[model samples]
Target: MKNRWIALYVENQVGVLAKVSGLFSAKSYNLQTLTVGTTEREDVSRMTISVKADDTTFEQIKKQLNAMVEVIKVIDLTTMPIHMKEILFAKVFNLNNEGKTEAFQIAEVFDQGGNVKIVDIGVDSVLFQCTLTERKNNELITLLKSRFKKIEVTRGGAVAVESISSSCR
Candidate 1:
């Protein structure tokens, strides 16, 4: 099935995530990614989800999601102008004093965008935090998976939508 990126603006309230997730689960939608956060307006939260669905089926999903009370708006940003970024935190273990070279090499992988920051480092563990587009972040993971023991990884689903022409950058 084709994939779609959808952005949802909703009233910031408890159970909002559950309500939207329920709709997708009920429809058997294959959710690939999701990200939610409070917007500039405290009362509004933005949600971005990536899912696989055919064109017609995707339309129905928008309809169903809109049925929920908290949902204020839903838009597919893939076709419109949009920018998306993903945050990744990874931990590497089994390091020693001699492994500094290898660790530096790994850090470079995430530093190109200058988003990767060394959050912490210890005798046997290295923690790195990074933010980039989903594609870029995944590529970095694939490159480092064999070199480091990626003990943990957490990603916000997706935050996407067409950019306003005046604000495009």
Candidate 2:
């Protein structure tokens, strides 16, 4: 199966998300990640949906989504040159001061000069916030999984847009 990313611009009204989700369920499609937020215009919302499907099914799904009444635009980002990222919020159990220091060091190294923030540090736990590419995020999770028992985890589904520039190299 090929992974696909689709962005939908829709009217910000009640039940819009439900209707869109229902369409996926009705078609027996599996949605991997879905992120929704208001656009520049308050009445319009942007949804980024991630799914895995074959070429034919991808086309069919896009067509159906465009036919929805509240949908303003549907962009298939999978085939485009786009930049995408996912945000992660995680809480790691820290049993002692040594564990806490280790957690902080891990976060510092994993930040990679990006938007990684230490949200909280308590006597027995540490919370972190990171915005990273999907691959890096997964790597972080794996690293943490081997080290600590995660108390909580949250993933902000991917958000993407077409790339604007060519190689600066």
Best by TM-score: 2
> Weakest 10 consecutive residues, lDDT, candidate 1?
160-169
**Candidate 1 residues 46-153, lDDT tens each?**
998888888898899888888888999988765766777777887777877666567677778568668887688887888778877788778777766766654567
In model 2, residue pairs whose N, Cα or C atoms come closer than 3 Å (at least 3 residues apart or on different chains), thus clashing, are none
Which residue pairs overlap in candidate 1's backbone?
34-157, 35-157, 81-162, 81-163
Q: Report lDDT per candidate.
A: 0.79, 0.88
Task: Quantify how close model 1 is to the true structure by its C-alpha RMSD in Å.
Answer: 2.3
- Which candidate leads the pack in lDDT? 2
TM-scores of all predicted structures: 0.87, 0.93
Candidate 1 at 144: error in angstroms? 1.4
Where is model 2 poorest over a 10-residue stretch in terms of lDDT?
160-169
lDDT of 2 by residue, 56-143 (tens): 9999999999999999999988878788889999898845888888888888998867667778888799888998887788888888
Superposing all C-alpha atoms, what RMSD in Å does each candidate have to the true structure?
2.3, 2.0
